[model samples]
Target chain A: MMNPTAAMLVIGDEILSGRTQDTNTHHLAGALTGHGIDLKEVRVVPDDTGAIIAAVQYLSDHYDHVCTSGGIGPTHDDITADAVAAAFGTPIDVRDDARALLMAHYEQAGVEMNEARLRMARIPDGAELIENPISAAPGFTLKNVHVMAGVPMIFQAMVASLLPTLSGGKPLLSRTLRLMQPEGVIAKPLAALAAEFPDLSFGSYPFYSNGTYGTNIVGRGTEASELDAAMARLAALFPMDGT
Target chain B: MMNPTAAMLVIGDEILSGRTQDTNTHHLAGALTGHGIDLKEVRVVPDDTGAIIAAVQYLSDHYDHVCTSGGIGPTHDDITADAVAAAFGTPIDVRDDARALLMAHYEQAGVEMNEARLRMARIPDGAELIENPISAAPGFTLKNVHVMAGVPMIFQAMVASLLPTLSGGKPLLSRTLRLMQPEGVIAKPLAALAAEFPDLSFGSYPFYSNGTYGTNIVGRGTEASELDAAMARLAALFPMDGT
Candidate 1:
């Protein structure tokens, strides 16, 4: 069975400007893959409303699921909630449940529930909130789109909270044959093997490490036997195993 | 003057599969920011030809420049050259200059000039070669799009070679004020200050470190004085110097 395809929409100026290295995308990618969700595409756009809305709408329409990270904070730049609301043409207001969650957390910590903090409680009508354990700010799910925090810790937590709710297919299995032979020498047989096993995907990664040049040929598929067969063929063609 | 905008197209299944962490985007983002080029968007697509062609065309038509990473290798999955050629309605063939470069490098190193290796010499019509000092496989530039290898070292080198060939605007200047206050407490005043300075861009990043929570307020603008004024207002509004 084909896994449900998902797309990640990362919105932040800090990432685009190179002020911050985005780890959320990487974290989500790995987690989604492990959970048997196929991540087909990832797009990173700055914290602009039009861009956010466009990306959200496009991804939500195309993919089975859309995960958005960043621009959901108390600051002026945090416009993700509004953009998402606009994308779905949904009315947004401070939902009582989200507000209560924030209020309780803040009260326990003895922090002031300022207007800026309350902004985190704003949710589009009919959207379900995703829990955030690291901070009081809650991510929400509207239709197929999941809006989460940009911070790696919170984004990861939200992902953990959200993945279990979604249906996942069989996880893709991959096998690697690490050979000391250079890609230039191995590319011919690798291409032939790839053509023979059309269903399986093949990737050759060249590495120069410890004064040795080599390639790691990865074969990935849902079927373990097919992957094993492909790996066996790869090993036979390559002959030598350096790794 | 406004900077030339660029969008990155990352072509690989490894990234989408969560098998590899793509550092090339972060590297290119920082490099483009330094070169005064506005990296407006980044899209990661799989190794599929149709997807690659679509992304390349979209990014090339939308942005002033397009930088594509990955799939330019000797293996069968390395179809970036063909996909890019199709995107531009151009024919691709093994060009003499590119073949000569690879041949010379191989001959110097006593490696065979195999058929798979020769595939790296394929260049799209009306394209210029971008030198890769790390490896003999050269990347090419078609129209405004610069296609490069996926390996971080080689990608960085190709970007370094390509940036100097393009025109650059004034680099954006940024100033940061670090305060030990929650973003919830700072968002309202920061938003007001952001409105007061329409030309500058402000970003607030919350961090929890050493059992303390704080926010880093960054102000960015092309004009140094405007940024300085915005920083001044931010500092006064926050009234903390915990940088």
Candidate 2:
């Protein structure tokens, strides 16, 4: 069976400005891979309403699932929630349930539920909240899009909470054969092996270290046996001992 | 004058499979920012021809420049050059200049210039080659799109060679003020500050550490004096000692 495809939309000016390096996409890609989902695409856009809305609409229309991180905070630049609502043509307001959660947490922490904090409670109509254990603010799922926090800790927690709820297909299995030979030497045979096992996908990644060239031939597929067979053929073609 | 806008397209399945963490985007972001070019958007797509063509077309239409990395290798999965040529409706073949460079390099290294190695010589028609000193394979610029290698070392080298050729605008100046207060506390005044300086952009990044919430308010503008005045107002509003 084909795995469900997903896309990640990372929204932040800080990432575009080179002030912050986004790790959420990498983390989400791994988690989704293990959960039998294919992360097909990732996009990073600045905190602009038009850009966010366009990306959301495009990604949502293309992929089975869409995960977004960043710009969900209480700051002025945190405009992701509203932009997402606009993308889906849904009305958003401070939902009572989300507000209650924020109110309870802030009250316990001796923090006032100010307007900016209340912005965190704004949820689109007919959306379910994704629990954020790290922060009191909740992420929401509207249609196929999962809107989450920009903070790494909170984004990770939301992903952890949300993944278990989605149905996953067979996990993608991968095996790698590292060869000291350059990719040019391995490419011809690797291409033949890839053609032989049409069910599997092969990737050759080259690296240079210590003044030598090496390539890592990775075979990926849902079936472990197919992956192993392809990897074995690749290993036979470029024997480590021979190199 | 408005800065020349650019978008990055990272093409590879390894990045999507979570086997490789992409650092090229971050490096390009910093480099473009330093060059006074605005990196407006970034997209990471797998090694698919349709996806690469679609992304390249969209980015080329939207931004002043488009930079792509990955899929320009000797392996079978390396289809970026062909896809990019298809995107612009231009014919691609092994150009004399690129082939000469690769041939010289392989001869010097005592390596045979086989078919797989010759694949690296493919260049789109009417495209200018971006010099790759690290590797003999050349990256090319077709119209607004600049296609480079995936490896970080070569990607950086290509970027260094390409940036000096592009025109840039005024360098974006940034100043930050860290406050020992929650973003909710700072949001209201920060919004007012943003409105007061219509030319400047304000971003508030929140952090939680040592059982306390603090925010880093970053003000960015092309004019250094304007940025400093706005930062001074923000600092006065959120006195550090008072918190």
Task: Candidate 1: list runs displaced more than 4 Å.
Answer: none
lDDT at position A25, candidate 2:
90
lDDT of 2 by residue, A54-154 (tens): 99999999999999999988878899999999999999999999999999998888888889899999999999999998778999999999999999999
Candidate 2 lDDT, B61-126, residue by residue in tens: 999999999999999999999999999999999999999999999989999999999999999999
Error of 1 at B32 (Å): 1.0
> Which window of ten consecutive residues has the lowest lDDT sum in model 2 chain A?
A234-243
DockQ of 2: 0.84
Cα lDDT, model 1, residue B94 = 97
lDDT of 1: 0.91
* Cα lDDT, model 1, residue B210: 95
* Candidate 2: residue B131 Cα off by (Å): 0.8
Model 2 ranges with Cα > 4 A deviation:
A241-243, B241-243
> What's the C-alpha lDDT at position B170 in model 2?
82
